[model samples]
Target: MTDHADLLELAVEVAREAAALVTERRRAGVEVADTKTSPTDVVTEVDHAAEELIRDRLLAARPDDGIVGEEGDDTPSTSGVTWVVDPIDGTVNFLYGIPQYAISIAAKEGDEVVAGVVLDVTKGEAFTATRGGGAHLDGRPVRVRDVVPLEHRLVITGFSYQRETRVKQAAAIARLLGRVRDVRRLGSAALDLCYVACGRADAYVEEGLNEWDLAAGGLVVEEAGGRWAQRPGVGGKRLVLASPAGGFDDFVAAVEGCGFTAS
Candidate 1:
């Protein structure tokens, strides 16, 4: 059996190492080498470099483990463990020198994520969790906020890079705006989820995110006493809704009431 605690420790270590590399490269200056999906979606040489470093370290520590990174091909594993990684979760923000980007890494057994970590590179904060082990920030235990009423809760969300999808997303946000205390759009999904996990925010909703984007942060939120659900969205996309226990039902209802569907 895999030791989830050990896996969590490895995740935090690898994530911090990757974050260091990303931070160093950003400080030294690197160019945006290419775009993916749309012009608004971008990749930098540092992204690739950081991913390579992460892959190397992971494989070095556990040669039998598989890896699925945002910037590279998947490597199969025979040990029943797969590492899901996003070397730079907010590439656009990284390119623009914004401080909100992060390095996200998660360890999965089958379909369940057993351990995860999200390192806010600029802020030097590490959010981590293990299956059933609760969540932590910089070595201190953290839990979701206990806000009860949905309307009083602060919510965070993100936009899709595709213009058409973003248009619809904006509309949905507009409908939800009046129901919540306020809404924020942080460029990084991983960070947004961590914010919900650590009581920085009450909830988060976003559509069109890949597994790598949610694998780590989702686990953190759940372990921090939060509820998260991925719902079906327009064009076969996935929408993620996460909130504290008190407002979970109302939040989900409000999301669907605003014309969003949960899977």
Candidate 2:
């Protein structure tokens, strides 16, 4: 078995490398090659290039390991380890020159994630964690905020690119807004989870997220003394909610009241 620490290192390294590639490409300006699911769901050449760079580095380092990436076909592995990667977590933010985009990577052993990292591309902040080890931001340990009332909590969330889903999601948000301190849509699920982990936000909830979007940041939140739940959403899709230990139940209930099912 590979050491969790080593896996964490690999995740951080690969995520950072991919983030650098994305940053350079954005600096050079790239064209949108296509859209997925909807016209609003955009994809650029940089996304593919970054994913390829990560795949190449990971396979070269551990040929037996598998890879599941957002922009590429899944590769199976003979080894128990499989890497989940999102080369660019916030393509819209990246396209708009927003600094909230990220490169996320995680190492899963069987069904468990053993290590993970999320690199804030523009900020150059690396958030990392290993199972049983605490989460960190730029080498300093981080923890979720302590007890806070549901109404006082600031929540971060994201919307689906599909207009229909976004409409439903926006309606849900409207109902949630008056119940919480405020709501923020950061356009990046990975960073939203990390913000919850590092006390930047009191909670995060969203649907229509892929495994790669949550895998890395989820571990960070868990290790930072937070709890999360993934429940069945409309159309069998999953909705994720993460909050500090003391505020989790209330946060879950608040979102559930807005019609987000909790499992």
Candidate 3:
């Protein structure tokens, strides 16, 4: 067994419990929602509520660990352990009853992610990984697909809600649409990366993601034999995620033609 696996066990437990709370509230009925930064960027009560639940449980379990979450802040410490969280990764979808959101939690040592979990609240799917141990979906080990040819790939991507960012992403989407099997914008970067890890979606690209949004999902993709890079996008720290063993070169070539590079 590995150290991350132990941490993963605890993370999985916390993430699933948070997911159940989200699903239960979603089923009851949603109240109206509002924007966070812009009108197009939506957030629901469930996001903050779930964050509170996950934050409390995780901090209680390990009081010394630092936390960085979408809804709140926990200062960095010298303890070398920090939990990065995006309690509800697709709050817009969750609010609209679209059923594609997730609870993303990650535990990191220093600057590296050691263990992480992404819980698909609507589907009851849990995707997890531990550094150097490999990635898994519901206890079954998973890996990236071995397909070649960008034209044959199913890529997933998303845009920032900001106006200028959305415009650039739209152009990029138009550039890639004609050359691939298909492109999807699922609205949940966490689930999108899990899709890349489990080989459901061959690749995922995103911009305007904070550290908490990409940390866990990035580790899952890496442990599953995938690749991850930070590309310049809306805010210049957007994440470009794919499989290193699964088509890294081609993914890079395809994406670079559109002028995205690490920020």
Which pairs clash in the backbone of model 1?
Answer: 231-262, 231-263, 232-263
The residue-by-residue lDDT of candidate 1 on 114-136, one tens digit each, is: 99999999999999999998899
- Model 3, runs deviating above 4 Å: 32-34, 234-239, 244-246, 259-263
Candidate 3, residue 245: lDDT: 63
**In candidate 1, residue 27 scores what lDDT?**
85
Worst 10 residues of 2 by lDDT: 229-238
Per-residue alpha-carbon lDDT of model 3 for 4-80, expressed as tens digits?
77778888899989988988888898764557768878777787788899888977877778889988777574567
For model 1, the stretches where C-alpha displacement exceeds 4 angstroms are none
Ranking by TM-score: 2, 1, 3
Q: Residue 54 in model 2: shift from native, Å?
A: 0.3
Model 3 TM-score, 2 decimals: 0.93
lDDT of 1 at 191: 95
